[model samples]
Target: MPVYRPSEGCIHIDALSCLRNTGITIYNSAEPRRDSLEVSVRTSRPSCQLIERIESILYSVFQVCWLEPEQTAGKVKPFFYTQGQAVLNRSFFPCADTPSVKITYSATIKVPHGLVAVMSASQWHEPSADGEFRFTMDKPIPSYLIALAIGDLESAEIGPRCDILIMPPSFPFGGMENPCLTFVTPCLLAGDHSLVDVLIHEISHSWFGNLVTNADWGEFWLNEGFTMYAQRRITTMIFGHAYMCLEAATGRALLRQHIDTTGEEHPLNKLRVKIEPGVDPDDTYNETPYEKGFCFVSYLAHLVGDQKRFDDFLKAYVEKFKFQSVVAEDMLNFYLGYFPELKQQDVANKPGLEFEHWLNVPGWPRFLPDLSPGDELMKPANDLANLWSSPEVDLEKVKQIDISLWKTYQTVYFLDRLLEKSPLPSGNMVLLEKTYPKVSKTKNSELRLRWTQIIGKQKYTLPIYRALWASSETARKLALSTFQDTKKQLHINVQNYVSKILM
Candidate 1:
């Protein structure tokens, strides 16, 4: 959509895409690239056509419990998921869709008698008896953050001020960060509570992205990176530091793999990237901003020699910039202002400590978060994996190891390490499934994902196929990858069965 300044007037639109009798007079401002327009019509009705595009604000119905026909008695419950990002918000209403503009908004929506509606604003858990819901956001947020969903929804409290919005079992992504109500996939209700980290990540956005904002799409990391770091901190508070470190290490590995695939010099890998004209901001989306940004911020905290000091700095930065948008340089300058000594020649001279190169250069930085805390916990898993790889190790002794002492993440680390090495013998594989019955039965999606990969790679067709069929409707990325890998190695009948199930 073209950028234009609106005068103190309102124009009625019958349609958005096509302008039939609509006429507007342009009043060019003296300032370059800044113009104002005025439009008025005396007709009893005025309208504009709806603009059609490949992707825009979407309003569609999805069926829940479709796979469980017997349990649900072939009943189809419909729900809606709205995706309004980039310029899609403009398709729904008149507004600039860029991150440069922030606005406070209010909405009142009327839904079906039995359905509820939610938005990215302060919300009431219960709708009015008449099925009308009202919301207001006091904090100014960019248009992309504006969201809406309507359905037969339920809510559960997870924290003091945080509540999880339970959607139909078939909803895709692990979760979506709407302001007050966070939408989560039904698979998370697997009962293990392992997927609660998804909720933590979304909760952290309240401070990192919602209160302190990014100036533009190019500095998108400011929103996500800070949120990732804060999410880890919250995770640490809830699940101990070892759990936090394990998650960070997992993210680091992902970042490295992304860098390897995208190339070290790729612009998308940079902490601060420039978007060429006509390029969709969504095209540049990846884990770089989330993980790399966390790495840089974590590295800075470690460099300062005190995590508390870094925490204090973050608080100060947010206090100063709350409700305002900023660029990457603004964040760097804030750090310099907070810790004036960092700008000194001696400090700046330190290797890999240069701010400019760290922010602008693409690829992994010279330093990463100290994963030693997690690596120490992983040592037992690593040693066990090594023993399993050797021919002389007795399978009986391998099964005797006290894996019950290990946490879910440690077990995952051990399993992942084993997968990286030579394939385990069939006997050892059988022993593994029997030894840690919980790993096979666990509802933790992360652990299940890693274990499923091992099962797929070992060509353990039956279990892998069963895992796929049982988990297929959840729509997890790792689950999808496992489905593809296992399908390749299974019998034709099994493959056909999986194909039908997935479809």
Candidate 2:
């Protein structure tokens, strides 16, 4: 497989040439039988010259191809298939190559008996014993939007805004929330309300990602960030304001991971793929799109105070690009169109830099945190930026300050700032443990939940877990319900910690 490098001029011509020369490359994708796949797709290439070019590009990316269709006993075959778009690339035609070119796709998949097949759009036909299923996606989508999954699956059907489909045996992340079949993971069977939460998120994508798509991978936030934000709104709609808080807190925690990894200097707007010496649009995936994008959009929602206006903005966005391609600039222009006030925001001060620093740059940007303090407000920011620069900074002063102050003020953001400075001081850890119990006495549910997240992640403090367990059932229910309701995501670490108390 040759290295992928998009040349400067005539991108279509270069891409076609690469596709013709490169063919397909498939490796063991954790599941061997489902590993190799290639398709010689026929497209509207103007000339043979263009056809040859397209072949080269495909070969480079997909050199190894396989047609095996079953999860053989004792062998880990590709356990699932969401080849909706992948099929177009491997079996039919390299199509909807870019969001700039939206193409309607119809797929015919042949598989063994007792296997279930699904796609991004609604199911076109029912299962048959002849080992074949035909599915058509009326909604034009980029090649990536197509999904194909095959497994020992049973689907549960229900209707709300759309028919809810669940495949309870597979712990697959999100399911197809199509008009007919909505695929879900086995976890939804936990009977938790988060199932509906996940379903609404995916269904909303049909309008955001499946409809109006991002033209370039450089603008994934336009795809992922918007979807995440939409999902949060759906959660809020179904569950209420508390759910939004949970989503926000969960998103913040995830974003912190990205920021800690990349550092504060990198703005969320600049996330991009890392390339080799010569690689075209390097395709590495990062949480920046999902996490940073959500954070920034949430911040925008914060800036635009009213829900009605914010919703109208989204509805307008969907209506404008119902079945078209969109770019980051298009979205920025859209926001500026509806909310003229946004146009006045200082671009320099605006908090959308992750993609700006990473994607638009040649190398990893230097994100050294400048903990050397100036003003009090900037101190925490400086401290956070410095943690990644020098991994050995002591966080004693930040931690020793009264937990009661942090608790009273509900300084989860402050705690987050300190935690962002990773490898925190030993004294801080001791201080945190000492102050852990005091949270139980406080009436502030937010403070308690924040403490649970922090302590839950550190050392799996059995003492705190036991305290939570020994507390009244009403308190436990209150904590969980409150955490679920708002942008305050209960620390997942607490789940494991709480589980230990049960054990």
Candidate 3:
């Protein structure tokens, strides 16, 4: 029976400190009405505390009815909850989602035989069979972060530090890395070579992101960006550094385009969350946030240059913010505290070299030539305003080019100007590629992303797909963003590529 409403009052949760001293049993049964459960010791707090929290969150977001908590043998039992949805809505409950929630938990669950039962942390003690298993989490965690799953799963032991789980026929593409419990979708079992990189990306998140999180969604870049960076490192470690460098270069290129196009309305640090009258909690996933956030972090890593400094920055950020929420300001403050040199320079004074342009501006940069009313068009007789303006200028050639040609060329030129003026030369390959090779350079990220779209739609190449997946995470992500163009059938083609790479 349902027992709560969504919009409710403040329900303070004093830590469930005595959970270990009490008896708690979780049942993952076959009863479709309420398949899973949480049975914890009786306390002074009413069972409504857990019920109210779950009910309110589910009702407000998903608008679904969660089965009520029942009292049996002086303990409380909560109902079945989807593990996939829970990861996205980890903030719904006040309970810590971090693995280090500082409380110990023990669970006894039952599922259909031959299916594995998984949760956070390592399986404490040996797992029981017959779809029944007992697990203890010595580490603490928030309620929302607590997870349980039961399905047809096969696992490959990929060495001591890594393991790959393959899901049954029903799950989605790729998988969710929940530490020892990586949630795999049935699609990934397709045996595609490209999926190996996707798997590595998710596995890296377990430690870099899920283990250590941002203080809130605004600071979500920490979780995503850092993880994005870590994926490259892991890719380098497992694959090779040459591949990683090429991939990173591609990402930077795509990121430059991403920042320039999105405009000023969608800020990286935007605080407002637009929730519709009725929308699924998972519906908010968007490209600008995840992809661009990763780019931003990569940008910062480019700024620091030294690997030790970069590593220390991440390690320190995680250590300091470990059980807390953080914001963009916090990230800047932390970075500035460690690197005072960055604080001393004025962003404007640095010109195209500084983070101020990308970080402060609301949208991506555009290079189209200004064709506003009353603007002078260069003519055969157009006088050079500056004495230094080349006297040998080809006015006839300039007149022959159409305004649109000028605009395209202008965009290419502006990007070149940024590069000539910037400090780090290595990170601009993608940016250069986006703009056509001016003086015999190479294709930038914008061009690569567009190229991928053009080629991806017409014909699929395993190499292009691999290059898209392996080149740069930023470029791959940017290419993914282009699929948002609703008019273009390219999006569906790209999704096919995503499935191939991810599957």
Better of 2 and 3 by lDDT: 2
**Candidate 2 per-residue lDDT over residues 47-71, each given as its tens digit:** 3333224333322222112212222
At residue 197, candidate 3 shows an lDDT of 53
**Residue 144 deviation, candidate 1, in Å?**
1.8
Off by over 4 Å in 2: 1-80, 83-93, 127-131, 160-183, 265-284, 340-503
C-alpha root-mean-square deviation, candidate 3 = 16.0
- How close to the true structure is residue 179 of candidate 1, measured as C-alpha lDDT? 74
Q: List ranges where model 1 is wrong by over 4 Å.
A: 1-75, 85-87, 157-160, 346-351, 391-393, 422-427, 457-503
lDDT of 3 at 468: 59
lDDT of 3 by residue, 1-503 (tens): 12333465343332232233333322211211121222232345333224323221111223121222321111133222235332333322223333223344677767665556666555645666566778877654434345565444345556886545554322333466655666654344433243355677777676555656554333445566667678876876775564555444434445555555554475442222233334332432434445555666666666677878988888897778665445566766888777777667542236664444444554433211112211232221123111113334344553454333432222333333333233323433343344334422323323232334433321123345555566567858754554343212222334455566633
Specify the highest-TM-score model's number: 1
Higher-TM-score candidate of 1 and 3:
1
lDDT (Cα, tens digit) per residue for candidate 1, span 1-503:
22222672333233323233454322211211111112322333324332333122223222321222122212344455555444445534545566677888987878887766778787454568899888888778877678777766555555677756765543435676767767776667767566677788888888887778877777878888898999998888888887889877767766876798789999988888787665667655678998988987887777677888989999999999888889987887788778877766445446666777777888887778777877777777888888877766666667767788877667767877877774676577777777679888877767776777776542234445555556535534555677676443333445565666555
Q: Per-prediction RMSD in angstroms? A: 8.4, 14.1, 16.0
Q: Write down the TM-score for model 3.
A: 0.51
